[model samples]
Target chain A: MAKQIVKALDGAAAVAEAMRQIDPDVVAAYPITPQTAIVQTFSQFVADGLVGTEFIPVESEHAAMSACVGAAAAGGRVMTATAANGLALMWEVVYIAASMRLPIVMSVVNRALSAPLNIHCDHSDSMGARDSGWIQIFSENPQEAYDNTIQAIRIAEHPDVLLPVMSMQDGFITGHGVERVEVLEDQAVKDFIGEYTPKYSLLDIDNPKTFGAWAFYDYYFEFKRQQTEALSKVPKVVEEVGQEYGKLTGRYYGLFDPFEMDDAEIAIVVLSSAAGTARTVVRKLRKEGVKIGLLKPRLYRPFPGKEIVELLKDVKVVGVMDRSIAFGSIEGCGPLYLDICASFFTYGNGKAPKVVDYIFGLGGRDILPEQIEGMVRELIHIAETGEVKQVVGYLGLR
Target chain B: MGELIEIRWHGRGGQGVVTAGEILAEAAMEEGKYFQAFPDYGPERMGAPIRAYTRISDSPIEIHSQITSPDIVIVVDPTLIGLVNVAEGIKEGGVILLNTPASPQEMRQKLGLAGKGVKVFTIDASEIAMKHLGRNIPNTPMLGALIKATNLVSLESVIRLTEERLGAKLREEAVKANIAALKEAYEKVQEG
Candidate 1:
């Protein structure tokens, strides 16, 4: 019930603690930057027999995820982690893991895709796979990385919610920062996140069911329907896990964590670790009597569009922070939300919040709090007079 | 509603810098505090520089995110001395604990810390690790010095975390050797 204090830890350590506490039966890992330390630490736990989890040292990310899929298919409580290019390598099998409905949890540290080839943090990698059937949760800090990782297994294994889940933190940002993160007691975590036995496992040799076999149109439609049906449980499962996690630890994790907008006239929405920087600015600007707030979207993929539109209903101005660049088009991830908000506005007959985009921190550049403050101020300025660029506000670009 | 204490770690790939950050966070969690630790990297390869961070808070933290500036910056490799701008974004009153034999004066000159008011401290952590642990990996030794330089956490905390993190065969020896390495560094550190 008590809290702990440590100097700092990065994203990799947060996931390792979750794995140790869960003590999965198998861990299939392939090395990649940012995500390497996580599997390495767990592999050590496996090597020393500290954990009874079967450690599978696979040769490649494709094989690493394939092994996890096999382990999960076999009904073994399995775990693993990979990022960026390694994830790209495993792209096909990832869909298999989801379609098969194996409740395997993995950590995906967000990294930029290569053209120029950068190792800094960005959303391009994850955004590319947005349509893949995994329940994705983006964490803004180390604490969330730990808690959400633990929650992923719980949410994924729920009989009503048997789909793969991936919790992502910015590669090298939340992934590598050393902050004091609260780790629940092994028993508490185990208690909070119960055993992860799958509903149907490949290990049931007696059951003798065909899996990963080809399905024609006759069975394909139903399977696809079932896949869609499983996804329908995500919102409820999120609510359930957030409730239980809140009961166990006092933190509330959800679709959105809005700040300073109780009665604010203008607001900003942000995601990932960058929200921390935005919050500091919101606090300072709020003290100056600025009517600005922050709407942070934690659940990115299963776009909580209506929920977000409702949250923005009364607000006059909204500034969306995109930690990525869309390049060649004005439509990066942030603009997708604008589309949702716009539809809601159309429903309200042109009575919705005025929307704009603020792209910042591409390639993991440092975005200062004052910059977020300035973005919100500019949004408020636009709201007061209704004159701002359609393509507006890219922070941290000199 | 409670505030959090955020920390960040920076080092190279081969160095145990990320390990040190995780072990420290684990130690604090053992103390029954709300804490989390993690690392940040992109291209996973040897010789590449890396960073790790942690957060300890009094209440539930919904905003799972990355740390920007850290309260304590732990440098485990001397090579990082040139590769990283290590002291950037460290809090005003924060301390920089490095694993080098250079004095605070020599380090300030070499590290170009003439203007910044942040405290600079160092310990021969690699030398200490080589002597005590018989390995070039200086994570534990620098962590020892870090615990000393900034009493952000206790030596017992570090040992507890070390035990939780280290392999059993090496656990006892590691606890003894690394703790000793920390004490050696702590005693040698100055507020210069």
Candidate 2:
């Protein structure tokens, strides 16, 4: 509700600005391409006395995440950023951070895992960590990147959902692209994400709490069930935090962002930056008298299946676009498509849309508006004919 | 929903092509216009050909992809003209602004775009940079020629933005020289 400041910043810079406002107690980070700017910018803020947070330039992403887990377990608000191989290196600690219930926020600039090396945008990195017990949220542009980064803190630190959260933006596309972002006043952000009050801490010698302790069959299953219960509480907390943030910033968020879906007969579901491109095409198709819409998932983990089914129940044919392929799956479909299939199966009461999978934009390949338009036309044909073509197809593959 | 102008820049890794696009986007922002600017990112190796893109519009831009068909193309490194297809995917009636001492007609012939309904503009940006800034960084001067080719952003806003953004990094005289080169390129750019 305060006066906002407009600045031209890339997704990384916007996130760093949010971090500066959050001013966590500790930021243990290792530099990696695309994500490096976030660490670099935040480090400068630390050096310049703009923020009182302790900035640690760790040796590697693994060490960086380990340090975050340690700091967070010690009851200090913690944060970090990395991409691709860096995230892969932190694979072990990522799960530990979540299972240990340490709410450390991280910025994941989504990059393709390397074999034939690439330093470009893709969802493979984050999608690989979908079941890591950490809450995941994706951003479409710098504005969402900033907003989501700020909200990730609240979501992760909520008492009902004491879990780590990774906020994601597409590498090079959103991470490096410059656009206008209306940043909140520093005091407004500080007031919004108030002091981090931990009920128990490693530093609390009087009331000791054992963390990362080995749990055998006697208690392990119970701990896992507890984690599931905690995660089940996230959607409510996310809604409340998002609503409060909306009141402050006038940008309300939900489990997913649906565009023109109320009366649509054909639609597409996507995530992250590609959603922006799909939305553009959906607008064009709507102009041509086609009832098409798009659903962009802002939250990926604890997949909002029932809500998504409700949104797409009326649409005749729906296409699910995935930026990362789920290797060895049905037709080697992308991860998002598999999730959509599961959502429909579990939640659809015989009202499921004719869903198709589109694996696209892997390793930072561009998904143009025309390519999306072609998919929309295909969806129209499928709607009219009542015959599904291939369940999974690669979009714009050479 | 309103008109969107997309511009693509061709240059080497060390030519500040990305910064030039950012500067233009920032200038557009100053005019209360929405814009997106980014490089076709890759491993940054000096002298390796690279591209950057910028889009400006009256409304918000939701699409985040490479600019396939650019309305304006600025070749910051003249040597890249032969090594790269500088005019590929250019729209008809689009403008190609090259930083070369050669005439626009010569560039049109070299690019094989002669009589293709695409306008070509040329300026000795390197010469302008060397004359004023005592350096061969033609990015700023090419921006001036871009303004002459397409009045997407005001010349004054570009100069002011250049001064503000570059002033923090370079000496005051260097910033002034860069502005001078920009003005000269704006005055001397030739269209064919």
In TM-score terms, which candidate is top? 2
TM-score, every prediction: 0.77, 0.98
Per-residue C-alpha lDDT of model 1 across residues B1-192, encoded as one tens digit per residue:
126667777777877766777777667665666666666755657768887776666554433445666776777778788778887787776678777877887887777776787789888878888888887777777777777776667887786667666655466766688767766766776557
How many clashing pairs in candidate 2? 0
Q: Interface Cα RMSD for candidate 2?
A: 0.6
Per-residue lDDT tens digits of candidate 2, residues A1-398? 76788899999999999999999999999999989999999999999999999998889999999999989989999999999999999999999999999999999999999987999989999999998999999999999999999999999999999999999999989899999999999999999999999867999999998989999999999888988999999999988999999999998988999999989998899999999988988898889898888899998998988898888888899899999888898888898888888988899986687989888998988999999888888888899998997998778899
Residue by residue across A172-201, what tens digits does model 1's lDDT show? 777766656667778887788777656677
Model 1 residue A226 CA deviation in Å: 3.4
Which candidate gets the maximum DockQ versus the true structure?
A: 2
Which parts of model 2 are misplaced by more than 4 Å?
A: none
What lDDT does the true structure give each of the candidates?
0.77, 0.92
TM of chain B, each: 0.86, 0.97
Candidate 1: residue B175 Cα off by (Å): 9.0
